[model samples]
Target chain A: MDSIRLNQLIEENYQKIFLLALKMLKNYEDAEDATQDIFLKVYENIKSFRKEAKFTTWIYRIALNHIYYMNNKRNKEISRFPEAHEMRTEMNANPSSVLHEKELFVSLENVINLLSPRQKEVFVMRYYNQLPFKKIAQILGKSLGTVKSNYFFAMQKIKNDLQNQNLLEFQE
Target chain B: MKCIDKNILLDYLNDVLSSRKKKHIASHLSECGHCRRELEKWKKILDITQEFVDQDVKLNPVPPHAHITQRFSKLPQNDESSFWVRYWVKPAIATASLIFIALMVFFFAPKTVPELTENYYVIDNVTYTETISLEDRYLDNLETLYLQEIYENEELTYDILYGDWQNYEEVLNDLDHDELEELINKMYDNEIT
Candidate 1:
């Protein structure tokens, strides 16, 4: 029964979790290891679930905790994470704008890595997961306003940083 | 409506605002140039943010190796009673059986008779057999006397080492303690004198 549930969970969310770990760890092997470890943890701790939070949210929190632990264990190195502004500017500015389009997608990845842990979480849940603000608030245990504001702050920072670098031009 | 604050603008961009508030923000957008421009920036941020959203964040499938799931299934689940027993029991039993067989092989085997240590020589149609007393202890020095000990026989041929030699364990089983000691002392005396 536990294995069945674990398989179900992995099948459903493995990709998202992999993406999270990849973005967080910024390497393929580490992300794969983290994903495997995360599932093992879920299998072990599923009984303690208690249903206090949404399962998806609980899983995300577990993944986040794993990534955080790994980051700490690795001594908080962000060298693999590209700078937030540089990604945005490079993505938003291009010769044909098509260059910026592909670059933007890749750069967004770097930007997500560059975000502060809190900002990254909120941003990922909002954008990647497409999770509702209320759900995010529940998952984060933060108020709706707090969640919204954090997201706002993240977007604002990215915008300002990109603009300062002259990578993004807001047309008049 | 105080031209919808930045927070409201953000909420509006995220499409989180209620229908009525959406209408109010829309009206404010038409009237207030600053808010409209702020709204445009937020929209661009939204558009830019969409770049990440459209991306499919997928974990690469596990590489082809030994099956991880199969291996994991073989592991004992945590919920069973005596989970440790489930994990360690089979391995422990396997190890004990191996040790037991090894001990029996060590202590109960028949002893080699040093007087029956056949050394052979072939002379025309006749074969001569010279038996050497090789105590197990003298076995160590056999390498030094290997050339002199060579036996040529019709059945054994010119090769004293023709047939495969038994393992030391087999040799150990065949030689009794006293015979082994006598054989060793004789070989030592022969070497010295």
Candidate 2:
């Protein structure tokens, strides 16, 4: 791909990819760095991208792989620094007594962050990115059943968390 | 006809189900209070999640930055000959050396097929292979965490280049111990530097 075409692709995808990285990494600076790195990886490997696959799907695959890698590294780094990790954990442990909109949002973010990696990925892609389950399956290289199962599990977790926090009313 | 599965309820809420299936689900939901209640619960969850995502996106708008494109422009263009040299020639040389070493071992050493009884067990008169070797298990663990290593170490760019992102698991699994160790060492070395 020529520089112009690469630039075009970057311009088109910058926000979507950034939002994905932000939601996945849950840190602004890390998301910014990841967005840049993801594009650079796209640029570097543009030559190998086959024509049959959609560009969006291909780019999403790259972004997701990079995000997962970064998230894993971040988790390992946190494990190495127990004090700081404990402090962050303590902060999250104290849920607000009042379920204000802002508090609800915070609780939602926490609930999302708590999801298992597979569930989180599927949920984020489905909810935030608005990617269809088929596309998510293609990107994750899993079956549609697997992707939907992950999303269902994630929804179950989020619902349980919200109800536990009294952010949403419990239903029988 | 039956109570809606949670997965199908979610698909219905997300508007991703086929029109026929969706209409069928809608009809079922109307007739069944239980399914309706289940759908309402999922709907609430979806609404809250969507609202939170909308607010988050609005709060964290992407700042204007032109440097990303500039960096892309600065990247060196693909060179065909260099690609072949880096990916093909080097691997060919390594394979040839391994073959040479194996040939020397074959010619110089007394070779006997070692009995593999310890690695197999009889189950219902069927020989079952034992668990994978320790080294294979180690490599399996490494492959599981290979994505982390790729991001932690920049030196694995070659691995990225050689493997398509879609098949990263397979590609990482194919990496031998020597390569994985070298990559891990490079990651730590870079961190120290």
Candidate 3:
């Protein structure tokens, strides 16, 4: 793709991709970096993109792959530098007031971040990106049933977590 | 009559069901308290998640980076000739050269026939056939092993496992007494759950 078309693609997808990265990575700085890297990858590989596939689906595939790569790399780094990771967690935990005021959000983010890789990817794509399950299946290269089940399981987990914490109330 | 499938309820939540199906679900929700409660639980979760996302976005607006576009402008142009030269022309030339060399060797190379007794001939033929069969099986086994490794190691393995909030444990472990007390104080101050 030419620079003009590339710019257009970037403009259209920048926030959506960033949000996916944010939800997947759970850190603002890392998400920003991942977003930049994903777009750069898109720019480099635009020639290999076939006209037969939907552009958004193709872009989403690239974005998800990049996020997974980043996550794996981060996991390896965390395992390598356990002390530094603990210190950072300590620093982030220092802001107790901010966290307390938004405990539900923090808890929700925690539940989301803890989801299994497949479930997290499906949930982020469906909930945060608002992509249809069929489109999510196309992007993830999984069957539609697999995508929907992953999403359902993710939702069930979130509901159970909220209920256990008594963050949500409902008549029995 | 039966409780709605969780997947269909999700579809209803997402508004992806067809209007007729959507109406069917709506009517069912009125009569089935169990399904209605299920839907309400999902709806509340969705609403809360949306609120969280909204607050996050408000706190951190992602403006597009100018440096990315600047870098894009610096990338080499996708010239068609360069593509063919890199992907097609060089490989084609190499293939043609190999074919030509093979043809030359077939036509011009000297061939020597080995003298063999009848017993030696039979033994050699049997050994050759056995070697060929063994090699074919060996190659088939190797290919299967390689493909199995790839399938197992593929990055996007969609296993059907539910999340159990392990990170929440990690977070709880990271907090000390003072931090926990501060967090509780703030929660009480804000009257938040």
In the order shown, the candidates' DockQ scores are 0.13, 0.22, 0.23
Chain B TM-score, one value per candidate, order as shown: 0.30, 0.36, 0.36
Off by over 4 Å in 2: A1-5, A50-52, A83-101, A170-172, B71-193
Tell me the spans in candidate 3 whose CA falls farther than 4 Å from its real position: A1-3, A50-53, A91-100, B73-193
- As for model 3, its CA RMSD to the true structure in angstroms is 35.7
What is candidate 2's lDDT per residue for B55-141, written digit by digit as tens? 776777785658766776775555536778989998999999999999999899987766575543332314543343335566566
Q: Scoring only the second chain, what is candidate 1's TM-score?
A: 0.30
Q: Write the per-residue lDDT of candidate 3 for residues A1-172, one digit (tens) a residue.
A: 5667766766867888888888777777778899999888887787787563488888888888889899899899899999998887667542222543577887877788789989988887776677888998988888988998898888889888999999887767
The candidate maximizing TM-score is 3
**Residue B54 in candidate 3, Cα distance off native in Å:** 1.8
Best by DockQ: 3
Q: Which residue pairs collide in model 1, if any?
A: B110-B173, B111-B174, B111-B175, B112-B174, B112-B175, B121-B152, B122-B152
lDDT of 1 by residue, A1-172 (tens): 4556545555667667766776566556667788888877875676676553377888887888898899776653445454753564465442222323466555555566678877877887777667798988987788988888888888877777666656666777
